[model samples]
Target: MAKLTAEIKESLAATKTAYFATAAKDGTPNAVPIGAYKLLDDETILVSDQYFNKTLANIKENPRVALTFWGEKGGYQIKGTVTIHTSGTIFTEDVAWVKSLKATLEPKSAIVMKITGVYTIKPGPDAGKKIL
Candidate 1:
């Protein structure tokens, strides 16, 4: 697997929140912010607590998900495949790598995303202009 860029990593870690989008079985989409996540590996993401979550249901309905992380410097919009594991052991092996960060995470809540593609979010004032 390829590695995440420093900017991408920083964007995710630097912020306490992230935005994720997932689609229902019918392809209808829903998105919302998650308070926490830890990078399991260069291509994997671990999120704690997957309950009462639209993303979780969407992932159940469709494994594909998109995560968008933003920071003061910039932000990354990541497109990846997700596996929502309700069990605590979901990404156990990866936790050691995130011990310092784990101190600030909510236990018994976890979801992992295997990143596949990424893009940058740069909204400009003129971005809203529609051209057909």
Candidate 2:
């Protein structure tokens, strides 16, 4: 697993929304704008699934996913493997976190992403270059 750099972490913190991409087993792709996500650690991210339909279904079929975000700090693309938690500790924490943000929002599941790769999304020479 790749560890996120401080710069990337700061960028993620500043980002309001990220584009999450996933693919079905047959390679059909799905992308969605996600606002509920947080870095659990340097190598892990927790994403709250509220209104996911195709995104959740694709994850069940294929665990691979990519998340990309840009902000004033910079931009990065993170590729990871996912584990969906509908119940247990992770799910419980997710519920609490989402509720803390807004009582009306319901988190159906917690998507734990174990980052496998980190790449630059910035333009110019190093675009798409793996950073970690």
Candidate 3:
């Protein structure tokens, strides 16, 4: 398990769009820009499955996922394992939040990822170094 620092949390919060990557069981890769997502806690992030098809299928076949976000300064890549929730307290909460943002947004499911590793993606001497 990895813990998210305050700086990382702030960057993620300010990020309007992030890239989520996943691979199918056969190793086909899928990466997409996710607009409806949020930090559920220090160790968890939630992504709404609004129009996910391949991403959802890949997640079900393989839980591993990677998220990359570029902020004003730079960005970091977060690697973790995801659990897809369709019906549960977390799902309900996520749906409500999505609805509040836009009543038209309907989340089919919620992808919850537990932070496992973090890496700096900012172009610098420390780029690609694992922070956690």
The candidate that wins on TM-score is: 2
Cα deviation at 13, candidate 1, in Å, is: 1.1
Question: What range of 10 consecutive residues in model 2 has the weakest lDDT sum?
Answer: 68-77
Instruction: For candidate 2, give the lDDT of residue 91.
Output: 97
Tell me how many clashing residue pairs each candidate has: 3, 0, 0
- TM-score against truth, every candidate: 0.74, 0.97, 0.96
Q: Each candidate's lDDT (Cα)?
A: 0.69, 0.95, 0.92
* Position 102, candidate 1: lDDT: 58
TM-score of 3: 0.96
Ranking by lDDT: 2, 3, 1
> What is candidate 1's lDDT per residue for 61-117, written digit by digit as tens?
788887776776667777778766644556464343345555654344456788777
Q: Give RMSD to native, each candidate.
A: 5.1, 0.7, 1.0
Badly placed stretches (over 4 Å) of model 3 are none
Where model 1 places Cα greater than 4 Å from the true spot, the runs are: 91-109, 124-132
Write the candidate numbers in order of decreasing TM-score.
2, 3, 1
N/CA/C clash count, model 3? 0
